[model samples]
Target: EVKAIHYHPENTICDCCQCQMTEIGTTIVREEAEFIPARMEKVQHIEHAYECKNCKADLSQKAQIKRGKSPQPPIQRSIAGPSVLAKVIYDKFVQYLPLYRQVKEWERYGLNTNDKNLSNWVIRASHDWLLPIYERMKNIMLEKSILHVDETYGQIINRSDGKSGQSNAYNWVYRSVPCQGPTIVLFQSSLSRARSVLEGFIEDYSGTIVCDGYSAYDKIEGITFANCWAHVRRYWLKADSKNGRIGVKYCDELFRLEREFKHLSPSKRRKKRQKHSKPLVDEFLAWVENSPFYGKNALAKAAEYTLNRANGLKAFLDDGRIEIDNNPAENAIRPNVIGRKNWLFSVSEAGAKANAICLSIAETAKANGVDFYQYLVKLLRDLPNLDIHRNPEIINNYLPWSKTIQAECVK
Candidate 1:
């Protein structure tokens, strides 16, 4: 609130020898920010029935009755509205607030709910409305010519294979290069981190993939693999010796040159790398190959790792569009890792899949610079009205980069 004070004409006279006060510019006295706690509201939809008065009076024909249609709920016969469901998911996935903690928060807002009910709402909403969007994003991401891939471990309370609840499951992430295509980050959950998992996602894809030094990616036949130099740098850092310091210097030089070429076009970047970065790469590889590290020490291990992925480490030099590291995929997968620290393992296989679906939607929304909560609310409130099943192409409009989504959900 703002209150302005003015001098009254009657009070303009001075006490003894006074004159009318001259006008002066206003000044800000004080300012402070306030916080308004969240609150909940209940909405009721009432449908009225009516009968034709004339037909009833005539009594010759039966009176016809008409009823109003109530708007569809996200889930039938459920108290959760689109906004409520969006808040639940946004809290868990984006804010990393577990359902049990949110239970207390919801109580503060005048609602008494448990985590079990919250979990049910999330699983149902993801399966019903969000899965289609996830699938659509996967299809569009695969179409890109360049992608970044990485994986981290997740725990499941119950394994589908009848293993112990503590067994490790994998959360695989795939991200697109914004310079080459739309910004998309997709998370996939797998029971096993086998070569088959990699094959399934990039089935017939022959495009370039920027990844870490994971052997699973090496077995794929038709794809071009550009390994991360950041991982190579990590290896040298672990060596912790004079030789390791020298290796670090070489790696740092390449990165410094890349920073200089950051804004260049693909073709120009490739040209600059060939002229400036290629020689440094060649010299580093030769030094690693001939370095006299006796046993399987850290220095020797670093040399072996670099020599093993020599082709991949040099892959970035040939294409300016390919990133020097898989940092994008790593950054995209970090949220799921953090959330796991809070909620721990998922209870069932379906629950695990639901986690992946929500993560994909949340991360993709963020990557495209959209407000995550707004995007979720928009999808839940609007998607049901669109006929995406009959015409699958209709989902393209809701993708994070689409013009419609940009106009409505971008921050």
Candidate 2:
């Protein structure tokens, strides 16, 4: 319970009747919804200096002054304590509460904090502590042989630090396939949805990528691409066909077989697909080449989409480890897209990068069964003291999927 209170009526004169009223047993005990103000406090750190008397007595030498050491502030020169800073970071990143909205909440509770100060705290924390963990997650995620890639638009402020004039930017997401060891999701913020962005992010990634019909994913060399069946269905489902029966039926059939194959081992699933799915695909392609829906209408568009992406759409038949769709990447980034509607925009590239780092860590932790709140609290409180630049190997222990984090953070 947050708190409790008792009420008692007094014996006093009635307001309008001007008569003495006697206290008696309660007729109705009322308990309604209420709230208690958040507990906020102010703290100060003072460093005391001491000088050696022997050193001071030597006039030819400079006085030796030693200052007592204190732990570094959560953000250098910021008054926000670790817990307070951690709460705000969690609120903005995980809960999707915008900084201005948080400012309003704090003002209602009578605190003097503002958005600028809170944003600075978040910026410092992201750059100083979280990016190393994010990079480590990137390295770990790339090791998977099969991954999913997807992109969603994120709004950034106009002329963001003069980095770009574009109002909308890309939040590219990549994640490992299900039933794979230690699931992870990684997000990268970019000024443009260029092919180079994916290339640079992938570096030398030589694995299967399950994605949609985007031309950008096609440019990345030396990687097998498995396209999403959902994209194919969306086109056919949206197309207003005069007789809504034939062209899109194959997509439905494939999905039905997938549902049955889900519980089977990958090798068994692959053999099943080869035996059952391949013939249906052959018939579908033959129909597409000879069908009457060959005009440039919606039906034609649907067929053309499949025919154009035939290789990618059918690549899943070759490997059981590859999921038939890019749904995992889409599902992981869906919350970030929803939160974008509330927070609306990032003011600078620094803030956009910060947003990506926080969302990546939070979602990845949650995907692997770790509670994001506790994980982030531990990160904010402890990560500041590590000397990562000097000893890069120290970051391996801090990764979300590492043995230490798995033991401590997994729910």
Candidate 3:
């Protein structure tokens, strides 16, 4: 066997000694160089200047001279244009990017901003530009034949009365119609009372309202209520998870009926209810009435839920207009819930209010088939220039469902 030598990879290695090169072992040399090129001195030349036409004076002769047209005052550079700003505010506030994150993004683009200033811009844009459209949407929601209502908790820091640093409020969402797509959501800050918020919204309106079993919904006069079967079925399913036979049976029957309902078209559903569903509903009612488990513990609770709200659950079958569930309203409010996860909470009540306004505009624009960004940009720019009396009709032009506006939108 022959012995082979190996060399390690380094900047310098002595081939004979196999020693690593150090800084002490070497010296760096700086070389100086000079290049001589032919050089020549240039002669100065001057041109004759003309006189100013307006002043009839020599212009260039003077060391300092003013031009005829002075530069216009510099228009301040905003981080974004009106349209871009509206989009940024909409995405950050309504779609829920906390301002600090937005500021960091802008910083990456070489623009500096703080959360407070961004918040102020959002408040101003929403209050001044977006609120009118939101109000219009609410008015449209009120006029619909049926409305779906639901409430969710919202937290606001520094709430009224100064009791605590944080307090719970309500975001009450109302959906006017489905498929045709007219929906509205309203946020109201309250200390856990639904009556004040619900009443305040629908005071002038009297129509059929679909909701889950909430006591606050009970007080509205002249408004018919339809309970969500989904809610009742959900409890039965919960009980079924715990291996309750009665719950399983009830849930199976409910799921079968719901499946049947799903198979029918909206118009066919209305007609079929009188012929087919009426009989199924009658059988279900009799089953509930005759069951030995009607007054038992967990099964009894599910039974009572169905029995007590039997009329409301059946109300949807009678009217084709009423939905099988309060899902439309729930769907409308879902974006807010998604946004809240990113935003965490509002800094103030005003911030929350601004958020509501932006959400209303964005959602309504979507419902109406309008491009939200374009619509918001147009509104922000034109709203300030609008004359309240003369421009009353102008606002109508922006309405999502208005025939004239819809025609323009289609075109």
How close is every model to the real structure, measured as TM-score?
0.91, 0.84, 0.73
Using TM-score as the measure, name the better of candidate 1 and candidate 2. Answer: 1
Give the candidate order by descending lDDT: 1, 2, 3
Predictions in order: lDDT: 0.89, 0.82, 0.68
Q: Give the winner by lDDT.
A: 1
Pick the TM-score winner: 1
Models sorted by TM-score, best on top: 1, 2, 3
The runs of at least 3 residues in candidate 3 whose Cα sits more than 4 Å from the true structure, single-residue gaps closed, are: 1-81, 93-95, 179-191, 241-268, 294-297, 402-411
lDDT of 3 by residue, 263-373 (tens): 566677778667766677677767776775555566667777778787887888887767777887888888778877887777777888887787777776677676666
Candidate 2: misplaced stretches above 4 Å? 1-36, 45-68, 158-166, 242-244
Task: Output candidate 3 Cα RMSD.
Answer: 14.1
Model 2 agreement with the true structure over 1-411: per-residue lDDT tens digits: 535565765657888898988777655456577866687676677789999999999999999999987777657777777777777878887788999889988776567888988888888888888898899878877888888999988867765446554456889999887667778888898887888889999999988999988889895777988999889888888786743356567788998999999999889999999999889888887877677667888888888887888888888898888888788989988978888988888887788898899898888888877877777777776777777789889888877777877888787
Where in model 1 is the C-alpha error above 4 Å?
1-28, 55-63
For candidate 1, write residues 1-411 as lDDT tens digits: 755655445675667788666655666666667787988999898999998998888878888899997777778889998999999999999889999999999999988999989999999999988999999888888888899999999988878788788789999999999886678888888888888998998889888899999898795777989999999999999999899999999999999999999999999999999999999999999998887865898998899889999999999999989989999999999998899999898888788899999999999888788898898898888877777799989888888889999999999
Q: How many Å off is the CA of 286 in candidate 2?
A: 2.0
User: What is the Cα-based TM-score of model 1?
Assistant: 0.91
